[model samples]
Target: MSQFKPRRPATGAAIAVLAIALTACGGPGGSQDEGAATLTFGVQAPPNSLDPAQLHDGTQRYVWGSLYDTLIYSDNEGELQPAAAESWEYSEDARTLTLRLRDDMTFSDGDPVTSEAVRVTLERTRDTAGPQQNNLGAIESVDTPDEHTVVLNLSEPDPNLLVALAFGSGVIGDPDTIDDESTALNPVGSGPYVLNREETVDGSTYVLERRDDHWNADAYPFETVTVRAIQDRTALFNALLTGELDAGTVDETQAGQVERAGFTLQRVDGISVGQIVIADRAGEVVPALADVRVRQAINLAFDRQGIIDAIFLGLGQPTTQIFNTLSPAFVEELNGEYEYAPDRARELLAEAGYPDGFTLTMPANLFVQQVQPTITQALADIGITVEWEPVPAQQSGQTTNWGMYFNLGAVAPPSRTVALYFEESGSQNPFGTTDPELDGLLEDLAAETDPEAANGIYREINAFAVENAWSAPIFLQSTNWATRDGVEYVGTANALFDIRVFALSR
Candidate 1:
């Protein structure tokens, strides 16, 4: 999901903590009977559609995660775990993956969760032109030899394939109604919870009733799960303070106040990397950006630490590399390669035959307004003039005249991150800048089967990208979650917010 700025309170002191009775047995509706348990979660937005194939990462996972069971599960630390499929083995060439499913599992509609269901779900997801379609592009076909055995035949070796399955690509839907238009609003899956249609209000509140027949029901602690969409951050914070929400995401600026109000704060660091993407590295738009020294000068122009302190409230780590800290490709030395040196930056600009610097055009949107002034001033100091073009958030991607723009890239495994941002076909590589050395390294990484060998190639790619100044990386973004008393949540390193990580403190 693209990063967007959330609305914050006008002033920190403007919010008042209201004393509302916190119930021990129920949700936002106050107290309930002895055996009833509920979890009311506040999300920034509601799911655009309930179809698993159409779902994207981030907030959408708050609902789809509980409603469907993925073939594999990713833990808090990003380790692969078994979910719908009890066991899986990769072929010697790493081109085929065999899965063994639990025969006892059944969907909410009482249909058996067989190998055919997995085949149909994967095929449907691959066929649909959705955000997750790219995740399954390597699959040549799916084979189901029996009711419980499913095998995936790949066209080539995919190092990130397993990790992809642990996310949206892995979500299994009911084959019977997955294609029906009604299934977009009403979903059917073999999951821990069943959507309560009577209590659900589309686009506002969704109530998911626990399914007793689900084999993995014990993993989810709440009997009833209510996901509410509160777009305004201030209102969501108020809901947490007033005991209307058991858990919700809060900005770093509100972390102190949230803790003082008796809510437990959980943070996952390095979920994303905020950077200035120099899209026209080939200098197709701006001639100066084509110079290696010019690109390096741009990297050294900004004071990343200062921006992190002022804009992020000191909740991030300054870095010059795009790879997340947890990734195997991350190199500690590269973080300090491009120190804040305005004099050196100016020297580099002069050496590149642009002593007066050049004018750069970039798209401006509400999502990037918070850091626009700082970026403009930083480039101005190094002799570059920035011309801002007011563009709607929806139209930001369509406008391609920009030489550079602020972006928050999702952190994932090295291979997946490379595929999504660095490769020619990458979503983030809008300009399609290609280097022969980088291309060869990426091809080697893709074909390598051994974990150690693949990671070594990733490190080489990381270093090469940094040396070339692929982007002026600022810092790693942190995602925070706040929970009321009696509730506990463990955040994941990824950008997704999975409800399964939540549980009762007791």
Candidate 2:
């Protein structure tokens, strides 16, 4: 497990004195009783809904992570570890998965966690029309052979099945209360913590108390876990400085301030990719986007390093592909495929029969407000005009009014990324964009069983996407987390934050 280390103080008598003073007070949050530790974590937003089906990634993970236990979980090293499920096995054909549960596990309400409960939760997540429903699309049916055994029958070989289960798709809840209206606010699970509904104020703060009788109590060391919704970056920074928050995320620009305040700054790189998605590839909304040269021109028009330096405060690395750097599909050479060249972009536009350039409409939302000016200026340099349409941040990505839009797509394994973005039924493929060659590659990847061979196919798909200029990816975004003196947080490479990753450093 990775541990946060204090940064060396800059050379200055006053600075050294302040660092010494902060260190003497046991860091920002002050000293705490190790035996009765309380971890107060702050997130940018509250969960949309407490229902497992309705819950999405990001802040929602901070909630569902404590309220429930997944069948399997990824450890600090990104390896799948047994959680509620003691062990799991795949069939020879890789089409069926068998899971064995720990008989000692029981829900907070004292109901035994049997195969029935697992089946119910998995089936509900699969059948529901929610964000994670498509993650389990490979499951054809769920079969319970015995009280402790559950079998998953897959329609095809899913290489990402285990990883998906380690995420939201594998969250197990009490079967009896799953459909109850109150369960949405009060969840009962066999996890290490139980929601303290009385102390939890919806949309503001959620309090979770430790369950001593939990099967794996050692995995979660906090006696109490409080997750607060502090959307404003300034407020979050203030809370961390004043010791109101034991741990919280901050913007890249504030890393120096946080480190100077005697807080351990943890960075997990390439968790997501900041990019412009050209959803309407058919040019149904923007006639100019239909040509391959036009898309290539857009890709070449952006100064990725300049954007990273200005907007991200030089905390990110420029990239030309959407795949995460840690993914097996990532090609090192692809990073330099599209260099910042406005002259080349203009040439491509002229070759595509639009020498005078064209007008492209994009959404204007608070989420992308910071980078809008830079984006507009970059495209303008290439003779393209941008018309921004004001829309609510929540409705911008869902609507088809704009031909292109800015988004931060979460980085996952190659297969999961493809299923979530490249597939016809994918969320990012809102217009059902399809390519016969890419479709063939995906089909082959699904049927392949060998890990090495599968990875080779993943690289091919990644290269194809970049070569075709399917989207204009700017850079691999980084996430920062600051923790107090006694709190040790193990960062996960993925986008979601797991509560189990925290431990009190007594």
Candidate 3:
């Protein structure tokens, strides 16, 4: 979900505290009963579609996650765990993966959730070229020898396949319910909840009713769930105060205020990295940015700590590398390589033949604007002139436009993050900068089956990217959510609020 700037009054925090106090006394209302087992979540945006293949945003996943089940589970640290699949093993050559499905699992449509179903789902995912196609692109074929056995044949060894399956890649749908075109609007899966079409109003509110006979009933305890999309943060916050919502996504800046209001605060590192994406590396519009030294200078000029303290209210850590800190590939030594140094930045600029620096356009978002003054000052100290351009609302997440734009977005696994942004052949890489050196390293990293060897390759990739300044990472921003009294929501490390687990206090 995109950040929504709050227009709170000077006494808004105090008002919120008092309002929450009154809410405790008054009890629940606005469609919630006093002791009802319903969880109404005020989301930032509505689901784009019900189909898992079409889902690309967190808001959509928040709903779809409840309605679909993946083959594998992800622990908070992103380690692979068991879910639908009972156990899985790799072949001796590490080029094939075999999974054993739970014998008792069944889809919501009353069909057995078998290995054949898994194969059908994965093959369908690959053929559809869905949002998660990259996650399953390495699979050459899927063969089901029995009802409970599925073997995946890979074109090459793919270390990310398991992680991808644990994430968006392994959403299994009922083969009987899916159609070629209409599945985007209608979804059928073996998950715990079923979408209530009668009560659901597209673009405004979505209602999900729990299935009593679901195999994973222990995970989802809520009787009824309602997801209401409120774009304005102020309005969403007010709804929480007025007992209109049991939980809502809150900004990191409002963490203290939410806690002060007696609401339970949920914090996580989120799936996305916060950074300044140098989209125009080829320098079509901003010619000076084409230099590697200039990009390195830009990387060194940011006060990441200061920005986190001021804008994120000390809720985030200064990002060290492109990979999330939780990933095994993360190199601790690379954390301070681009430490804030105006002197070094100036030196790098001079080395790049820009002793007096050059002018470049920068796209500004709400959060980016908060730290713009400090960033602008640092750039000016290093003889770089920045022209701030307000991001067009329609083009919020598009990278086709030139300039240093804020990348407040999601990329699940570290390997996929590298592939998506850095690789020349990556579908998401708009600039298409060809780097055979980085490409060769990524190729090796992709094919490596040994975890330790993969980590080493990742370190080499990190060293090359840091030395070349592929992109200037700011920090991994924190995602904050707040729940009313008597509600428990365990936030995921990926920062996804899995609605399947949301439950009211007994």
Worst 10 residues of 1 by lDDT: 14-23
Q: State the local distance difference test value for candidate 1.
A: 0.80
- Candidate 3 per-residue lDDT, tens place, 337-367, comes to 8888889989988988888889877777544
Off by over 4 Å in 2: 1-30, 359-366, 387-402, 492-496
Residue range 408-429, candidate 1, lDDT tens digits: 6567778777876677756567
Q: Which of the numbered candidates is closest to the native, going by highest TM-score?
A: 2
Clash-forming residue pairs, model 3: none
State each candidate's clash count: 0, 0, 0
Pairs in steric clash, model 2: none
TM-score of each: 0.84, 0.88, 0.80
TM-score of 2: 0.88
lDDT of 2 by residue, 1-506 (tens): 11112235246686556434423433225454434667898976676677777667655688878878888877765666777787888887888898888899989998989999999988898888877787788899999989999999999887777887877888897899998888778878777888898999988799999888887665565778999987677898999988788998787878888899888877888877888888888888888888889999999998899888888887778999988778888999999889999999999999999999999888887557768998899999888999888875333363467778887766776777787668876767767789999989988987787779999999998898898887899989887889987777776665357886665543
Look at candidate 1 and give me any clashing residue pairs.
Answer: none
